[model samples]
Target: MKLVTYRHNGKTSIGKVEADRIIDLPRNDPALPDTMLALLQGGQDTMARARAVRGDYSVPLSEVQLLAPLPNPSKFLAIGMNYRKHVEEAARVGVQTPPTQVWFNKQVSCINGPFGDVHLPAVSDKLDYEVELCAVIGQRCRRVSREDAASVVAGYMVCNDVSVRDWQLATQTMTVGKSFDTCGPTGPWIVTPDELGDPHALRLRMWVNGELRQDDETGSMIHDIYAQIEHLSTAFTLEPGDLLATGTPSGVGVAMSPATYLRAGDVMRAEIDGIGAIENRVVAEPV
Candidate 1:
């Protein structure tokens, strides 16, 4: 089932997507949780209930303003240089591939709706895009093994890991550069693991102003999702509603010879097979 959070009648609600219609869960069953995070924390029982719900009260997809599947994730983390090609591209610019999986925090404040506008920050001129597949945690767990990682994942979504190249390279943490407001664009909706099948085999592509920029498959990840979970859980508990960006492919603006960075009015479309796409436009930071 594809789950979404959308605004209708000026109020936000969680719903399920069917074709071009959004079946509002709360309207169908008053007992259901109204928010995505709350519903996720309810676990399997909640999901079962969601599955049993019928499309009694639904609105056209065009009528509601779709928000990020989970508007407020508890922790928004990302893996870096997990793709061999991307790592190789980094090496050309003097960045070495890390011996172990490298993870960074993308401040939750940076989260934006799948179709929201991305701002060309007035503070930085070197903005870049990284198309990645995002895994959404279903249950809270720590010290999970690679074999058990699949059980903890609820769904997947497409994400654009927007970066400010200058600040990222300037900092040791890479948090500041990755966490700029409106930088993290994710959604369309979450496709449950069962529906999505193999998370490792999806195709990921990114286009800027109608020009193809990045193209690769999820199978190319060096660490893969299960290994990443095993690695990250050893350090901290993975909570429901937490997000993990699986890392991007080889082609990115900074990797280009002349560095073709984003400018105002550029439309960036990031798509992952199975899980829909998000199209965001670049605009000058608002005053």
Candidate 2:
């Protein structure tokens, strides 16, 4: 199932994607939750209900505004230097690969829609983009083994881990730079685990303006998603609707000989083969 959160006619609701339209789930069954987070928390039966719903009210893809599929997830985390090539690229920018999984928190407030605008903060001009496959947690679990990890993942979405290179390098956590408003752009829709067979074998790419700048495959992750889940869950509970940005591949702007940072008016298109694409335009930060 491809699930989406959208706003139509000034009212926000969750829906299931079918072809180019969104099946209005809440409208079909009044018992259904109106938000993606609530539906996930409703557990398996709610998902089953979402799958079974045949709604007469569906909005054409172009007619409604698609929002971030899971906007208010409890945790919005990402792994850094998890791709060997990206590891190599990081070294060029004076950042090294961690001997262990390096995780960072992208505040939930940073979440933006699939086709939203990314802010070019007045504090920095070193903006960059990283295309990653983001996993949405389906159930609450702890100490999940790598083999059991797939069961806990609800689905996946394409994300642009938009960064402010200067601020990112300024602090070790990479949180402040990563947590800027509108930096985490994800969705188009979430593709359920069953619908997306292998999470690690998809092609991920990002383009700035009209030029392809980053290209790689999910199979290239050094730590991998399962290891990430197992490692993180070991320390705390993994809840439904939480997001895990698996990692991004190389060819980022900061790695270029003459670093190419994004500016206002730049359009970034981030895509994953099985999930979909998200296009965000860079705009000056609103004061």
Candidate 3:
């Protein structure tokens, strides 16, 4: 089932997307949590309840505005150079591939709707895009084994890990460059794990202003989702609603010959097969 957080009639609610209509869970059952994060915290029981919900309270997709499926996740983490080609591309620019998984944080405040506007920050001009397949963690667990990692995942979504190259390179920790407000665009909605089998097999593509700049398969990743969860969980607890971006494949603007960067009016369309697509327009930061 496709779960979504949507705004309709001046109010925000969580629901399930079926065809072009939304089954308003909160309206259908007052006992269900009103927010995605809360519902996720409810675990398998909540998901079962969500699946069982069937009622007349529904709205057409066009009538409601779709928000980030898990708008307020506990943590928004990302992997860097997990894709072999992306690692090779980094090598051309003097970045050495790490021996182990490289992780970074994209502050939760950076989260934006799948169709929201991405502002071209006034502070820098090296803004770039990284189309990544995001994994949504379902349960709270620590030290999860690689074999059991799949059980911890709730579903998947398309994420654009919008970056500021200058700030990123200026610091050892990439948080500053990665955390710019409105930089992280995710959702279209989250597809349950059962619905999206084998996350690594999905084809990922990103287009900037109608030009296909990034195209690759998730299978190209050196360290897949299961291993990533195993690595991260070893260090900390993986909580429900925590988003883990599985890293982007090669073909980022920074890796281009002329080093093309995002400017106002550029539209980025990031898509992953099965999960869905998210399109965000780049606009100049309001003065």
Q: What value of lDDT does candidate 2 attain over all alpha carbons? A: 0.92
Model 1 lDDT per residue over 1-287, tens place: 99999999999999998888999998999889999999999999999999989999999999999899997888999999988899999899889879988999999999999999999999999999999999999999999999999999999999999999999989879999999999999998999999999999999999998899899999999999999999999999999999999999999999999888999999999999999899999999998
lDDT per residue (tens digit) for residues 167-280 in model 2: 888898999999899999999899998999998899999999989988888999998889999999999999999999988888899998889999999999998998889999
lDDT comparing candidate 3 with the true structure = 0.94
Off by over 4 Å in 1: none
RMSD over all Cα atoms, model 2? 0.9
- Candidate 2: Cα lDDT at 60: 92
Task: Name the candidate, 1 or 2, with the larger TM-score value.
Answer: 1
- Model 3, range 103-199, lDDT digits (tens) per residue? 9999999999999999899999999999999999999999999999999999999999999999988998899999999999999999999999889
After superposing candidate 2, which stretches have Cα over 4 Å from the reference? none
Lowest-sum lDDT 10-residue window in model 2: 89-98
